[model samples]
Target: MRLRHKPWADQYMKDNNHILIQEPFEQKGCWKQLFDQQERPLHLEVGTGKGQFIAGMGEQHSEVNFVGIERVKSVIVGALKKVKAKETTNTRLAYVDAEDLRDLFVENEIDHIYLNFSDPWPKNRHEKRRLTYPTFLEQYQHILKDEGEITLKTDNLTFFEYSLVSFSKFGMTLQEVNLDLHETGDETNVPTEYEEKFSQKGQPIYRCRASFSK
Candidate 1:
């Protein structure tokens, strides 16, 4: 769902350039320098909506660094605000498209990726636009380390099933598949804004962890 353009979003992005990286391409392989702990593992959240998950993860795991990628300025501004509120040195936001991920990171630069409630792109003609599409997967494979894993969560069963098939066809091994994530009462699960809302209404959340290493 496209967010309504916020008139102040652009200014907010500029004002918080430190937390919201303006020229992410320039950072490339040196993303770790942005954090205090440069040696810590780096994780990327492909579609960090409203920044709830990333903020929670940063607070929970101070030892790891997190970078959130969101193309929409209006959407990312919310994430920037949350991260800024936390005053965390390990979390950063980038206003860039997912398609340009290769331009922002070098090979084997990323340790893990999180895809939370990405657009289903359910129409047959839009299959190629899905995040789990082969082309996107290839981009992910290039930046991710050999043992890196992609963890995904979605409320849409169709998209989840499609992602499972896509991963399998790409020779990626599924390490874990949870048909109903919330049922397990996993305290480690960081709920995004959408996840919390869906779970509140009795919606089943599907989650899976897949890696390129077979």
Candidate 2:
């Protein structure tokens, strides 16, 4: 997705330093201490596009701590605004690359990982760039607790299939698979901005839950 240049985005991020983590590497393994409930389960959202999903999840599950990491400054500012508006104390936003997961978190630090509408990187040559690639899976397994799981939701069918295969190859067990999420009328399912837009256009939404422990 092409993002419009926001001249003030950098400054805006600095302005919200309290909730927006500017230097995530420094807080590695201490994320729980950043929130009011230090013992709450910590959930990390890989690519929080626009922030609607993470903020909504925070409001829905107060017992869980949410940290949304988005690399794009312009795109992340939008998410920061949503989180700020919601004032969800258990949630925080971070501006960092997914590659730095190891630098920003320790083993068994995360309870769950969320991948909402992540870029498919469709080309065969770009497979390594996909979030479900082995490199990322290894990092996820190292950081997630024994029972930690990954919850993925996307509108792309090919990407969904590819992710399932990737997870299976990595020895991750698929706990749940939903081909048509909306059709199931699962009220507990929170919709991201992209999910709402695509579903409104009559597109099917695919979701899967895969545990790190095989």
Candidate 3:
């Protein structure tokens, strides 16, 4: 995904305390304590495009501490803006590369992981870069607790199919799978920025919830 550099994004993140976690490794296993909630199950969105999904989650489930980390600082800034406007107390954002994820989270630290509209990395040679690849799934394993769950939403059929194969290849058991999510009429579904835009254009949304057992 192409992203424009926001001249003030860095400054905005720096100025807002508790919104963007700086040097997240320092808080590794105890990240939830950073929010006012001392003890709560933690949920994370690996590539929160614009924070719509995560922000809604934070607002809806105040008991769960929600964390969103994005590789692109400029794009993450937009998520931060939405989160800030809502004053959602149980959420935090951080700019971190997905490849270095293990460095910032200790074993069994996360309860659930959410992936929404992540980059597909279409080229076959670049399969390693896809978020649903085995390498990334291994990273998720290190940070998730026992029987941890992962929820994914995407509009790309190829990537969705690839992810399903990757998940099963890595011993993940899929609990729910929906090829056309909008048709399900699930009221609990929270649409991301891209999900909303794409669905409006008559694109089908694919979603699944899978669990990884230790």
Candidate 4:
């Protein structure tokens, strides 16, 4: 499933000046600059859609390095365009699969991971494909620091409940589980493309933060 091979994705990639890093899993030390020369920790966003969330986070947290991983080339291009438009030097986008994150990042290298509105994989047969699956959790634990946190937000109730159970099974501590993100109408919560669409339909957004205990 090469995203660049799709017609729409090809145009989007060309329209945006996004340098596609194929097989990021193979380039283990390519992101050394994200941590080198700085004491600030590194943050990663899995399935960054259109880049709004990570770009906003980078703009607010200039001291931290943000890396956005998107499997879809079209989406990655849009995210890179946002980063470029904002002149955000603290952030970078990679066209990489979430399952390969462990291969790309070293152990205890990542400080935080943002899983915003990832694919729910609604079908029972596709449960393993869910971002919150135990297999993926293991990979996340391997890359994240002892105190690293994973912030998950989604509009799907089934996925949210499933993720809660999965986190508990993995011995991860869950915190700040919010069923409705807009209850307080906090301006700090930057909504992503999927979030915007789902929220417009009057759907309640579920959010929770989990941390690895080493």
lDDT of each candidate versus the true structure = 0.93, 0.92, 0.89, 0.80
When sorted by TM-score, best at the front, the candidate numbers are 2, 1, 3, 4
Give the clashing residue pairs of candidate 3, or none. none
Sorted on lDDT, best first, the list reads 1, 2, 3, 4
Worst 10 residues of 1 by lDDT: 1-10
lDDT of 3 at 165: 97
Question: For every model shown, what is its TM-score relative to the native structure?
Answer: 0.96, 0.96, 0.95, 0.86
Better model by TM-score, 1 or 2? 2
lDDT of 1: 0.93
| lDDT tens digits, residue span 119-179, model 2 | 9999999999989999999999989999999999999999999999999988889999999
Error of 3 at 212 (Å): 1.4
Per-residue alpha-carbon lDDT of candidate 1 for residues 23-95, written as tens digits (9 for 90 to 100) = 8889998999998889999999998989999999998999999999988778889899899998888899998
Strongest candidate by lDDT: 1
Best by TM-score: 2
Q: Can you write out model 3's per-residue Cα lDDT over 35-150, one digit (the tens) per residue?
A: 78768898989988788998899888988999998878888899998999888899898888755678888999899999999889999999999989998998988899987899
Model 3 bad stretches (over 4 Å): none
For all candidates, the clash counts are: 0, 0, 0, 0
Per-residue lDDT for 24-45 in model 4, tens only? 6755645645434356788888
